[model samples]
Target: MKTTLTSLVAALVLAGCASVGTVDPAQLPQAPAAYKAQSANGAAALTASWWQPFADPVLDDLVARAMAANTSVQAAANRLAQARAALGGAEASRLPQVGLAAGAGRSSTPGQPVPQPATQYNAGLSLAYELDLGGRLLHERNAAALDVLSREQLLADARLLVQANVARGYLALRALDAEREIVRGTVAAYGETLSLTEKRARAGDVADLDLARVRAELAANEAEALALDRRRLELETALAVLLGEPASNFRLAPTAWATALPAVPAGLPSELLQRRPDLAAARSQLQAAQARVGVAQAAWWPSLSLTAQGGGVSNELSNLLRSGAGTWGVGLLAALPIFDGGRREAGVNTAKAQLDGSAIAFREQFLLALKDVEDQLGALTLLQQQGEANARAVSAASQALKLSDTRYRNGLVSQLELLDARRSELANKRAALQVRSAQYQATVGLIRALGGGWSSDAGVKLAGV
Candidate 1:
């Protein structure tokens, strides 16, 4: 019997060794060494606190609130907690289960040489453990662990998303504020023109047609300002939602758009794979799927378990632990499904299908990450050129407006010429502002694409990874 047991143990070990499922070491897609777009010179590393570089105090406060209270972020955290709990359960399953039990019963004999009431009491400790001969339990435990790591990465990704959104929204709002100021200045100038035109008409020094034109321009500028006001309200309310507050209760006082843009160097493309939490989560999920395949395949083999019980039994509770009342037993159990009508085969096939799906999804995510970085880098480079051109346009228009204003005051130019110059200046300035806003937004996009500047890749992993 001892020799048989030794041989069975050796068989179990060999079965376990042979049960490994195929999961290649993370052969994630490689990237070109350098980004295709022009890299920013002297760019600093992106950090977890990506928005802090903007140096906007209001933005800092808003991001802190969003991180703490945003519904999506909170939900992600809850999911992470659940994953950890599942991991704990899986880990516990790998260890022996021990429990204490106590029971009491009374019985009466009906017919015999003598009939009497009898009482029995028993107390004992019981233990059971799976030898994991087929490695099913081991794979289950590993799958759970990988799930936990995946959840952790998802949580980080959620935080990154929230911060990126807040930065973009706040920057856009400030740009709107800046644009509204420009419109307000234009309206003031138009009002002055209207008043002067009226006075000149009263003195019969200007035609009534010119006076009407001035009044029309003032009204048009006022309408533009009103339109900006409405747009600003929409943006403000949207931002309020991001902050996880009621729109009616949250307010951001208009401030100057002086937030500094951070320099973002397009690092090596492969580095993006390590830094992105979403990609990391995808990799973990793929690994977990591979583990599940192992678990499914394990079902084709036999399972071995050990169980033991130790206790004392006596007619009375006081004698339950008496020397002669001791009771003990142990069992070695093995089970192999004789037939399941192709159930095991179906399960293995299903798991492999899922593994295949996970691999494809991971590849898609990898491709998207690359696309995101390229899109933003190209945007930033192009936006810089646009900004430069718009700036020159604004400067030229301002100079033209000044010349027109002097000519009109000396009666060398008509009021029409002066009005045209002012219109040109206003249009150029607003265009410049739009380009600036794009630059800020694209910079934030690039930072998000780069995975909020994460550096660590430490976490739970599957075997042979």
Candidate 2:
């Protein structure tokens, strides 16, 4: 009766020895039904080639090159390979281990040596299998697998970020191109005006002050054109770095902006949460932490292993494998630490703390994902409205410039008035271009926030704790 009672208590102790973790994801906030931003039902769906929707063949090529050569993308892939290797090691540990041993030694009793030194030859095949009574191996393997998954998602995230950055940099560079064109065009027009003003002043048809003002305006516009070129060069150098090429030898020629601006459709919020690689990575890390916590707790329990050895020993090497000289043995090992200061408890506590940290990190990543999508959505919606308004402003300013120029030449308006009209026209045109550029960037941003691309069926199931 006492033996039965003791066995029951031991069984109970082992059953409750280990756990995944204390995190209850159910207690965390849930994903909303739909996004709180403007969305279209007729928008094109997302594809694996996220940048292709821009419709710029050049952008498509750049993204492909960066994916293949970008340093950050390469680094992430390397980390994933390492994690896979670790997972293989963990899996190997779950199987039986076999080893072969061989040795030859010479020995002699100081005064009792018969002929010479005695030679001993021994060889053995040994096998060991640990029974997962404490579930340590299982938890360790689980943790390693989760780590591999986490690495995969992290790699995805790295690629997504690089892709987004390239699109952003390229779009901004193109915007600069468009802006530079406008500045140069304005400068040329101002040059013509300055020439006419000089002629009028020499013929006594206009004041010298008017000619001086035109010259000042021409110089200022020329300076602005030069400034735009300098900015363009800076952008090109940075893009070269993104493509994993040295800035010194890399150059991106100013090309016509033919990229399409497709409206991003808002999909189900649940789908968004699942498709985000960063969120998936955070979830995998959290699950791995929970598995590690179980592994740490398992340290407090006894480990049971079965071992077997078959061998032969003989003074003559030739007879080492003979039946008469053969030997065999088997054993079952159970180990429980009597004492190790407070290390085991400390390890368990550390694991629990890590689990807690991972849970918080997962929640933070989830919330951030939502915020990112919302930010881009809001920006795109407002930019669309702003672009319409800017276009009207540019139109009005252009008309005002034409009137001012005609009146100034007809001697009905001052030179200052003409200059002011030119300034307003230039500013309004630049503002419109900036708005267009922002709309492109925000569209890309929205795509990235929606997990680098959109797909109706994209979903990632988080590992249960």
Candidate 3:
């Protein structure tokens, strides 16, 4: 009866000891149900190869090359492999460690006229296991497993970033190409205007000052065209670096302006939460930190280790395995912390602090994701409106230039008026192209905000955490 009471008391004490730190995820802030942009029922779904929707074969090829050769992508893959190996190591702690040992040695006595000689041989297998009665080993394994998931998700995130960057670079290149064409056209028009003005001056129909102004305009246009060429070359070199090639060895064909941007679907909140690798990584890190807390708390409890060894020994190496010349033993040891200069307590405190830090980080990530989605949605909407406005402006500017040229031929407008109209028309056309470029960039930003072409099923398969 007394023994039963003692067991009950011990069980109650251990139960009290087990409840140290607690974290309730429900207490954390929740993510919004949907992004600011609402899609129609026919909204397109996001694909892993999202950049392909632009239909730029060059961009498609570039993304493929970057995935295969980019240094950052390779580094993320290596990190994932390392995480997997570390998780395996953590799991190994749960099983018994067994080893075999064999040895032979001879000893002699000193300070004797006739030396006393002895020989010994031994061979045995030793087994040791630390019983995880409090689930410390399992918790540590759980933490390591979560770390592996975080790393794999991080790898996915890295790939997504590379794809988005390639798409952006491709779009910028095309936008610059359009601008260059506009500048070249302006240069040609200005050269014609300068010739007309010089011919009029030589005939005494216009003053020499008019010819000088036209020539100055021609020089300015030529300089602008040269600047555009420099910018385009710089973009080309940047793209080559992204593709892991030398700048001199890489080239891109002219940009494809006719390609349509890919439309993305508005997935349900549940799917979005699961698809965003960064969010998943944050959650995994939190779980890992939680497990670490348990591991730290377990340090306060006594540890039980079981060790056993059985082997044969003989005076001669030949009889090392003989049954009669054998020795065997087993040990059950318990270790309780006596004194460690406050190291263990400090560890526990550090783990608790880390748990708090992880919780804050997870919440911060969710907030940032929400903000990104909203910002991109607003940006896409405004960019589309701006693109339409730019188109109308380009059309009006073209009409004004045509009318001005006709007026100049009829002697109703000055040559300067014609020149101004032509320059305005050229600037307006380039601005229109910039609007289209902005729309493409906005689409890319929205895709990135939505977590970059992830599939729920794929996320589940690749990141089982």
Candidate 4:
């Protein structure tokens, strides 16, 4: 009987290794060797501070402030803290629990001993520990720890999003500033042409219709400048929100758009699984779900626990500590679910479903990450080509405007012709600014898609603000 009991205990100990679910990174979908839209190869890996490549100090400052103060970022940080606390709680559960108890009471016997009253005092220390016979506690702790990891990755993702938003906003603002200047320059040129036409009309060298046309063009140019101003204000206010400041107190002075576009290396598709925080978070969540399945499976097995209590009781408080009044007890308890009407089976099924869902979610995340990189790469490539064409168009339009102005002054062309040339030049210039702005935006997007930079060692770091 002794040998049989020992064998039974050993088998129960081995059963603790059983798990209901498993996750294999290798089982995940594989990535392609190269992105279809990639135009370059063998570039350096992105840095953790991806925005620094823009070479704009102001943009760098804005990104830092957003990461530090953005509401979403703060919320993620709080969640990470909560997950850490939960893991701590789960770990603490695996250790023995000890408690102290003390009480004093008075009681009276109603039907015996002449209705005498009695006083009692007692103090005791109690201990209890679950034996983890089927690895339930271990699986629970593992799940909690994975939850903490998931939250940490989510926080990193939040920071990456904030940084990308700041960069985009700043780039748009700069582009609008450039467009505003172009409109203002066009308005001034039209004003000069209108003045020249007025002088010619007074000298009877030009018709009233010509003067009217120049005046109309001048008014339209001024209106366009005004519209640009309104758009600039709107973008400024939006940026203020991104920076976590009141719009009334925040302002960005107009500056030249000199931001550099950083080249992003299109690494292997597998690298994305490691670099992207969202992917990492998804992976952790899947692991946590698998661990929970183990927990559920363990519920079908018996739970074993140990308990002990030592105490002393006496009628006198002073004698409570006496050895003669002492009492001690110890116990080993095992509980097996005798009847729960399929509750345990239901729990197992639920856990299995959750695990399946998590695996699907992880695959979806991976696919989306791949799509994100591809989209950004395609945009950057197209935008670069468009920018080159726009630059050429701007140069040609500028030359045409200069020639038309000379012809109008020499009385060889109508004021309307000169006005058309000026408008064309301004439109081309604004279009060029827009193309450049889009390049910057796409650069930021690609960086974001690549997981907000790379590290040589342990993937991206979440420490830098």
Candidate 5:
């Protein structure tokens, strides 16, 4: 009987080892040439901490706050802890489980010691171990470890989001500041023009209609400037909210007009697949799901367990460990799932379906990421050209506006013509400012889509924030 049981346990163990399903490591997607934004390999210099490249102190401050205070980041950290705890728990199953028992009781038996009650005491240690013949525990451990990896990727994704948001918010604030300055200049110019028009009307040189028109234009410009200022304030408050700070406490200093756009690197699309944190998260999840298939398949096999216990029983407390009062036993158990209402089968199918779904999800994310990089790359290229052209237009308009004002002062141009020149100059400046802002933001977006700026080949690890 002993030999048969040992053979049965060994056979079951071997069967478990053979039952694991196979899963292939996913390959990176094809890199598209369209994803490249520049001719130089400058993007290769991108680090996960690419936000630091801007060297903006105010931006850095806001990023620090977002990293520390963002609820999403904290939540990812909690998930990592949970995964680590689960891994610890899964590992515990690899070792034997030990327990202790103790009892003292009084018992009476018929015709025993002239019907006297007898006192008894007992103590023992018990141990049980499930032989890992089916590798179920091993697969479970692997899955749990992968879960930990997935959580780590999630944390990275969270950091990326925080940094991107900070960059965008800072960019928006700066853009609004530029727009407000342009509007203010227009308001001041309109005020001067209105004053001149009123003086001419009083001297009977210009008609009242002309003066009324100039006053109306001045009021309109002032109103527009006020509206622009309100919008700027609202953007400031929104950015502050994202930093998890009171809006009043967060202040963004207005920056001068930015003339240059950051350079983007042209890298292979395949490289992007390895750079994105969300993609990494998806890959890790897929790996975990594949491992779960093995865990589930392991359930179809018999399980082997070994147990042993040794203890002493004695009527007298002092003789508990005496040779005559001591006893020991060892046993091995094999459990074959003969019937369980098809629950095991259902579990296996569920795990397989989940694995399939995970694979599909990974592919979908990869494709979407590729699309994002391509779209941003195209936008960055076009916005840079547009910014250059707009700058030239602004310079020409500035010269024209100066000539128009001089001509008007010398009585060579009408008040309506001066107003037209002023409006044209203001519109050109506003357009140029807007184009530059778009260029800045588009550069930031391309960098973000490329996975926080670092390639897979770089050994640099992006710290949180």
Candidate 6:
């Protein structure tokens, strides 16, 4: 009998190991060799802290603060902790459970002898464990471990997104500041032009119509400046919220614009699978789903469990300590499903459907990641060209405004022509500011799309904690 039992245990162990399913990495879709929209000059590798390239200390501080205090990031961290705890519980389920019990009770029977009441006292230790002959427990534990990893990746992704949002907000605020300054300068220039036109009109060298035009131009420039101020206030308030502060209590002083554009390297697309935290999370989820499928499949087999209890019982409390009163027993229980009204089949089908959904989600995430990088690359390339052209236009407009001013003073051109030149110069300068703003926005966008740098192994290291 002993030899037969040993052989049966060994066979079950081998069969359990053989029954576990495997997932092939090659079964997943492949990435392209190169990005279609990557620029020739975008060969510089990105660093872990991609925002540092902008050389803005305030921006760096804002991003750090947001990561630490943002509500969304905090929520993600909490979810990660929950996943870790769940994994601990799943692992514990796979091990033997030992419990101690002690109790005292009194009972009476109506049809018993004269001493019908009796007192009972008991103390015991109990042990129970699943044999895991079908690998069900192991598969569940594996799935839970993968779930923890998925939550970790999700937390990292949240941090990445928060950092990107802070950078974008800060850069936009700075761009608005720069644009406001340009408008202010234009308003001042228009004021001086109005003064000169009024003097010319008083000296009978200019008509009343010319004076009215100058006044109208001044009013328009002033209105534009006011509009810019309103926008700046709105942007400042929004940025304060991103910093996790009340808008009324937060303020950012006007400062020099940092429009430095960082070059991002277009690495092999396959590397994205590792570098992108969202993709990493998706892959982890897929692994967990695959493990759950195995668990469901294992349900078709029988479950084996072992239980044991050792204790002492007696009518007298002192007698309970005596070895003669001791009681001990062991048991081996096997539960085989004969008929469950198709419950097992439904469970297997559900697990398979979930596995299929996870697989598709992972593929979709990969494709979206590729699209993000390509879109940013295209924006960066086109914005660079636009910036160069805007610079040239600003310079030419300035020269034309100067020539028109001199011609109007000499009566060689009408006041309308001079006003037109001024408007053109201002428009060109404002357009140039917009182009610079777009370039900064695109640069930050590219950094975000590239998974906030190439630090593929960068993650929340909570191992010791």
TM for every model, in the order presented, reads 0.90, 0.94, 0.91, 0.90, 0.87, 0.89
Q: Which digits, one per residue and each the tens of the lDDT, describe model 2 over residues 97-138?
A: 999999999997577647477999999999999998778899
- What do the candidate models score in CA lDDT, each in turn? 0.83, 0.86, 0.79, 0.83, 0.78, 0.80
lDDT of 4 at 181: 84
Model 2 stretches astray by more than 4 angstroms: 1-18, 110-115, 266-270, 458-465
User: What are the candidates' C-alpha RMSDs?
Assistant: 4.1, 2.6, 3.5, 4.1, 4.4, 4.7
Best by TM-score: 2
Over the stretch 349-437, how does candidate 3's per-residue lDDT look in tens digits? Answer: 89889988988897888788777676766776777778888889889999999999898767788988988898889888988888788
lDDT of 5 at 215: 88
Error of 3 at 57 (Å): 1.9
- Which is the winner by lDDT between candidate 1 and candidate 6? 1
Clashing pairs in 4: none
- Ten consecutive residues with minimal summed lDDT in candidate 6? 456-465
Candidate 4 lDDT by residue in tens digits, 433-455:
88888888887887788787544
> Which of the two candidates, 1 or 5, achieves a greater lDDT against the reference?
1
TM-score of 4: 0.90
Which lDDT tens digits does candidate 1 get at residues 1-465?
A: 999767765654554355455655465565557677856555666455778888889999999999878999999999999999998998898899999999999988898778788999999999999887667888999999999988998998898899889888999999999999999999999888888778878989899999988888889999999999999999889888888999999889998788998875544444554557888888889889989998987876787789999999999889998888999999999986645787877888898899888888877887898888889889988998899999999999999999998888778999999999999999999999999999999988877887874233322222224
Candidate 1 lDDT:
0.83
Higher TM-score: candidate 4 or 6?
4
Can you rank all candidates by TM-score, best first? 2, 3, 4, 1, 6, 5
Query: Per-residue lDDT of 69-106 in model 5, one digit per residue for the tens?
Result: 87778889999999999999999999899988878889
lDDT-sorted candidate list, best first: 2, 1, 4, 6, 3, 5
* Model 5 ranges with Cα > 4 A deviation: 1-28, 33-44, 106-119, 255-261, 266-269, 454-465
